[model samples]
Target: MQTINCPRLIERVMANTLESIMISDRRGRIIKVNNAFTRITGYSESEALGQTPAMLRSERHPPSFYAAMRAEIDHRGSWSGEVWNRRKTGEIYLQWLSINALEDEKGYVSHYVAISHDLSELRAREAEVEFLAFNDPLTRLGNRQLLMNRLDQALASCREKGEVLGLMVLDVGRLRPINDHFGMRAGDEVICTQAERLHLLAEASDTLVRLQGDTFALLRHSQASVADMTHLAERIIKDLSRGITLQDKSLLMRPSLGIALFPQDAMNKENLIQAAESAQMQAKSQGRKMFRFFDHGQHSEQQRQLIIEHDLGELIIARKHTGLELYYQPKMCLVSQTVCGAEALLRWQHPSLGWISPGEFIPVAEQTHLCVRLDRWVIKQALQQIKSWQQQGVDVPSIAVNLSAHQLDQEDFASWLASEVAHEGLNPSVIQLEITEGAMIRNGEAAVALLEQLQGQGFSISLDDFGTGYSSLSYLDSLPLNELKIDRSFLQRIDRDERSLKLLRAIAGLALSLDLQVVVEGVETDRQVALLSQFGHIKVQGFYFYRPLPAAEFRELLDLQ
Candidate 1:
């Protein structure tokens, strides 16, 4: 066997090993270093040799830390922990280091050997993770966690200073609609631009945060009163109402703002956020581009609505197999006083809550993608009923089902509707879709194209609740509408209001000119019917003819007719 030189063996081991190896003489001067030591410290072996390891010390540790490390090494012969060191480039980095003392045969310390692994990347990654936990990925604004922390700190300050704090929750009301229209990239740009605007609006003492998608929170301390909060909310609303240009297209962000004052509206962070959100909801309900201060009554109503919304989500999921029914309201031709078509309206047959009104739950459904499912379910049920009615020898001409903006804009709704209709072996002409003016316009060009597609497939489309929304006359020509239903509001005053009469005549004449049939809704009285019937061949539907009925009851009405 060949005998190995001990010093050469030690040098080979140090040179081959990956760990940074440094050797110091008994007097604490660096005697040697391996290639890894030079690589990690950005120092050449020639530069590092003869220099003490203290030259690489980052000065981050307290004297006590070094003293404890020394004490451990003296007592236990080795010390292992994290340490901060500086590279030759003057950049500081963390290192996991293990140090051992080497002794001669006399048992006195002769040299110190330290093995270190560079930990800069790991430390940076840890710091980045911490930052991400409190920041929004899209806007780099403080996130929900940071929002809560800031609110907690503000509440504590309010307590100490005996001053009021204003917490405002802002919802970009147009975000979803804009996303549907322009795409998510533009939506993200809008959110980022809004964040910058909000950041500018915030004072140095205020904390502005993006809590979640299209939702932001601002905490303002040292508010003089609730009025101050209101003013701030109004300022936010005004600033956000201005249009933002994205991809060279102008987009408006109508912000609905809610303000809750701490120590008055809420005493804690969660409750404060809840109250501000409640107020923001109230603002949205009142109108878009507005602000509302938290009122106890509104808050309570919001809480009740939240419960209904939660239940509504569950109800929608189980609607196909369980708690859902269609109620038909007969639409009668005014001249014959005979039913021409029936409107299919949704009713939630809640097991515990009994009959929940569509007016209450439909809005809740519209807020989520569940509205698309609900719309599809309504069509499927309506078409299935039509087929059943025809089989039983009941002549149901057409069934009018209301359409929502969300459902209409769904990726492939037109094709899906056609597929569903064909699957039931039902004639497309036997189904009429009623869309409100607001929903129609909200969907814009996409809606016009879908309406034309449905019309091309022999499906009738009706512009329902016509006069309530701000629709341009140019849109009427663009859309493939088969009918225009006069809003019930106009009919309510048609008997007395000459202006209402003239407006009705003009709308009916316009529909006729466009070759679209005219329908009048909410004909609850004989006088209203008589007034509405005077308009040539217009049709009528209301409580006066028949309240909405169950499928069986409606079938009975068909039989009686």
Candidate 2:
């Protein structure tokens, strides 16, 4: 086939195309230029005709950059990538450029064709995105992502040089209140000013980053020891606690710092930050303007508590799937010596964590708002067991479920309990609620009203761990309580301590005077049980008679009764 050369067709296409197109002779002198070339380079075709492509050199790139680019194009016959070039007005801009050598007959290079797309706007947008991703826009400080990257690098350097890397997490405790009182704009100003102050305190090798709202992180590279970390944290706390002025008003800011060390607290980036956060929590707990070093034991405990909290959250959602459990310890009448009732004790049998005591997990649950759900589950389980026992013709009188302060503090707790009990189809008289004296004391009037409402609904209310808290007799007289349970601590020392017996007797007398049934807990020894039997018409509960039993075992005990 015979080929036809269409120079005019090529010229027409090049002139109308968006991409800048230029043809240069073998000596690299521009031979022709299209409209797009003029548009992108800001030079007319007439002005560019005799000029070399070197006229567009941005000078941003070093000599080696051009040399390597030229070598690649010559050897490969085509090259394409990002390049910086100068416009006719001497302004530099980025471009995606492609160049190909045009060959003459016998494969001799005759001319070069170059095409380029303006990338200045695209590059600018990319830079903005990258900046936003790794920086806090409000404070212009490195964000958490950037902090993680720097932490990873810091850890690697520490390992290589046998140095310690210290990480400090600072929490601005007053920022929330400041934001609430002064507005977000003022809060932002405080943050930016704090960042500037923190940046000024940082060493040349140290990195200051913003982790999240009112939280900032610092990476101290090549630290000497715990002393170095503590010194740095102290300096930061002192400097930051001096306060900043926002809107012409001086406001004091409290700084709580957590410091974690390399190869000591953690060896990786994530754990290092976590350790620092743990220490920061400890610092905050100890009061503001203070710092705490990451203790291995404390971090482990924090992590374990975190795991328990997480597991409890999951268990709350999956209670029906066997995440939570309840064990019952029988409460016996002193005169009859048979099972009168039992307390439904919350138990957690984590699939992997095994059995966790209520003492270990209950506080965590209460703190995380999981207590209400957990308490509901306990009530449901207790009601189910009660129904099962009733169907089996067992004479179990009542099953008491403990309520946390968190539960009683809820505004609708009484109604919620009544609804749950009714939903389970269990008679309210057969179910009892046990509340600690502390809970009643903390909740005060709300607790009393709820307890009275529940009592009015035919649910027996017992004040558990009665004498442990400093609840006055006046307060106890006003509570709509059916029973007062003597705390285990008094019973633990009942056999040996005369004072304990006097205290127990006084408490028993108080319960009797108030027309409340008295129940003594922790009746472990036979001697103590005998001593407790003297109280007459009292109830006893503890390990001597029965340890807490699983639902199945408790059911068997009910059959035996």
Candidate 3:
């Protein structure tokens, strides 16, 4: 190597460096400071020399903190961190400081060289950009970006403190319908109303964020337990469920609240959101006007549902051969014990996992939009079964398969049903499509009028879960329905609860007055059966007799008795 002037090269490099490098003697007096030091810190070497380094201390740092830093540098020979310091003219700035101990020939401490970079403008720019990026323009609350950041910070805090934080995903419910039905001006008014409500709901320390599409998030630094979060969730439900008035017409806006708590729901940001979102999803799935907290089982259950959603299409293809099977539970005449029909339930017999219940896969099918295909399969299978039973000298009434709302939403719904029944060469009267009372509703007159065509096709229609829907009795009076099935929930409580008994009696009386047959469900006890029998409306089914049984088992029963 060429001969090099090592000491001169080091001094020149230090003088030109972007950072301010200064040397202080063991007594803490500045011995020398470089040109960069004068330029950035606004102090000339003549002015800074011989002065104590204390002149640069901003006093924001605790005395003990500096003492500890000095101790670390004395023991370890170097220290690095962001610190507050003062420049000339008393301007305070953030400084990234790094100090290295200068050694003597004998390894004794000789002096120290500290390099500092001014961070004032940089920090200000950062804060401004962060605010622009993460704050909502309208409400000035945290936007989705800040909500995400807040969640991350909360996750980190939870990791350190071992406490749970709760996230409430709030949806502004009535805002959309009002905006759509009324006007955009009404929408803005509704949003402002909700933003004010959100501000009032949150503690001063808590962050309320405006997520997109009129949704908001309220973040809580919950206590160690989730009980506190649950109590808060209930309070939100009660508050948001109250009515709001616009132009003196009462409008209802309820939150579909989903909560996620740390450690219990999830440990990380993504997972915590998913847990909260999963709970909220469950709430919305149940009809979206209440609070739902994350349950461990719900998390695992959602995972299982996701797996089914992804894999069910493939599962359907594989099972299309030998694994696909249908089970039917009999719906009998109340007193005759004669089967009126059966509801088809899909079962998957995995080669390794054995049978999978409809309860497990049906929801998955619904979520993945696979239910339409599954429904098609059920229709073909049920008609074939009815044909087989008819040929075997056993009388089987019409077959019923539960129709999902998505199934009805298909553009070819009535045509598809007609085509499927025709392709199966089955009598239209032998097949009945059971639509939930909720799903049977149509917003457009064209949609409800479409159902009138289905009624003309020699097919029977039954209103499922007749009492648990939004339609008034007057609305029901206009619809053509051959039968009405009382929800299992009402009849199950009739034997023990007076309120339920009266509700059931009223429903039975109304169905009869409308010239409709009523089917009571969930008759698990003989007393329940006797009560329905006494009322002369004994058409029922539940665990009292049998859960759904496979075709083979049900066929064998037909042979035995």
Candidate 4:
């Protein structure tokens, strides 16, 4: 091994090491400093040379702190601990400093050596970890853990002051569908935008928190009365009602708020949150842009819906179609008095709950991607049933399956649907896709393009519940559509109001002039059928002809036809 020069090796080590090193003479003035000292303190050796350590003293430590450190160094000849020091630029920083006294042969202190390690980076990392524990990384809002902590304190204060505390949970209804239609980045933008809006609406004393995906909470301790909470919820709804433009595409976020009061809803944190969440579900079930307070009577219904949603998720995960069945309702062509097509409707028979209404469970499914999955399942089932009917020698003309807006928004939905039909060895013309006008309006131009793609594949597209939505006449001309199914509401008033009758006739005439097929739904009376027959070549679907039946029964009906 080569011999190492001690002095040269010490100089190289001092120059390269990250820890700042300083040497002071017995007179207590800095005599030498390593390169790290200048780098860490923004001071060159020349500037530091004749300066005492007092030059780096900060106001954070009192005179006694330094005095004790000096005493320890004097008695024990060494001291090591954290210190607050000022850099050459006058910025206060933290450093772990270790000092030792160097003595001569005479046993008297001659020089002092000090090593400093910057603690700024370490301290920053610690703070960041703590922050992430309590805040949502995406929105930078308080998370559930922080919310529960704040709630406990707020409730304690409320109890002492005899005041009420309101906890409001707001659910962004269309967020998941937006994520599915747009991208996850777009979904993140929506969430951050909503969080900023909520921050602006929150009172100074109110604590805003992000619970999880598309759900946020606000704890209001001041002005927490029913009237105050109502006003806040209205403001939130109004503020969020405006469209958020993402990538030049305008998207609307519908908010549903649920409010639960302390002592009234529940005294504990968990129960209070549960009550607020239950109320939020109820608000969503009622409609979009709605708010509701916790009601004991509706709790059971909300629980049932929760169970339904959970069970639906399980079924989708397991790919089990146990209780799910597609019922066929025949559509009659008045001109031929024969079934022209059959609308496939979904029905669920839960093992214990028996038959659950679509109205009850569909909204629950719509809250998540379950609705999209449900729509896909319906499409597959309809196609398979059509193939089965054909194999059984039943002459079913076409099968109509309802599509949700979420399904239409999917980037590859049209291709996937066409592939499904082709997989069944059936022509696309045998399948009819029914979409609501609201779905078209919500999806904008994308929906129209998807419909055109499906139509180009030889599939028929029908605008369902026509009069219930925007009903833009422009859509009638622009959209690639084969049929229009008028909502039943229009026919309910037809027998009593002559204007309603004239309006129906005008709509039917306009559709006929455009060479589009027209179907009137929910015809329950003979008088209504007689009135509808005058419309000429229109199809009718409702209880008047036949109720929705199982596949076997529907096959029998097709056989008789």
Stretches of candidate 1 off by over 4 Å are 1-6, 57-76, 152-163, 171-196, 221-224, 234-256, 263-275, 278-561
Clashes of each: 0, 0, 2, 0
Candidate 4 global TM-score: 0.58
Candidate 1 lDDT score at position 223: 67
* Model 1 error, position 408 (Å): 15
Q: What 10-residue stretch in candidate 2 is worst by lDDT?
A: 315-324
The residue ranges of model 3 lying beyond 4 angstroms of the native Cα positions read 1-299, 316-324, 348-360, 442-444, 497-499
Model 3 RMSD vs true structure: 11.5
Q: Among these predicted structures, which one has the highest lDDT?
A: 4
Q: Write the per-residue lDDT of candidate 3 for residues 1-561, one digit (tens) a residue.
A: 899899999889987888899899977789989898898778899999999878888899999989999899989999999999887978888989999998899988899989889887899999878887988767778887887888788778877877778788877686778887878887777777778877877788687888876777888864635677677667777777777777778887767888877777677778877777788878878887787888788678677666666567886655553577888887878767766667777778766556777778787787778887788778888888877887888766667787777777777878888887787677788887777766766434544665677789877777787767774666457766767778888875776798988878877778778888777777788888877776675478787877888897777656654
Task: Supply the global lDDT for candidate 1.
Answer: 0.86
* Sort by TM-score, top down from the best: 2, 4, 1, 3
Decoy 1 TM-score against native: 0.57
Two-way TM-score contest, 2 vs 4, winner:
2
Q: List lDDT for all candidates, in order.
A: 0.86, 0.86, 0.78, 0.91
Per-residue lDDT, model 4, residue 437, is 89
lDDT of 1 by residue, 26-57 (tens): 98899899999988999998998888888898
Residues 1-561, candidate 4: write the lDDT tens digits.
999999999999999999999999998999999999999999899999999988888899998999999999999999999999999889999999999999999999999999999999999999989999999999999999999999989989988888899999997768878888888998998999999999999988889999999999999975599999999999998887779997788877789999999888899999999999989988888887989999977987767877898898888778897899999999999879999999999999999889998888887778877889899999898888889888878777888988888888799898898889889999998989999988888898999898988899899999999888778877779999999999999989998999999999999999989999999999999999999999999999999999999998988888887
Q: TM-score, each model?
A: 0.57, 0.74, 0.49, 0.58
Q: Pick the candidate with the highest TM-score.
A: 2
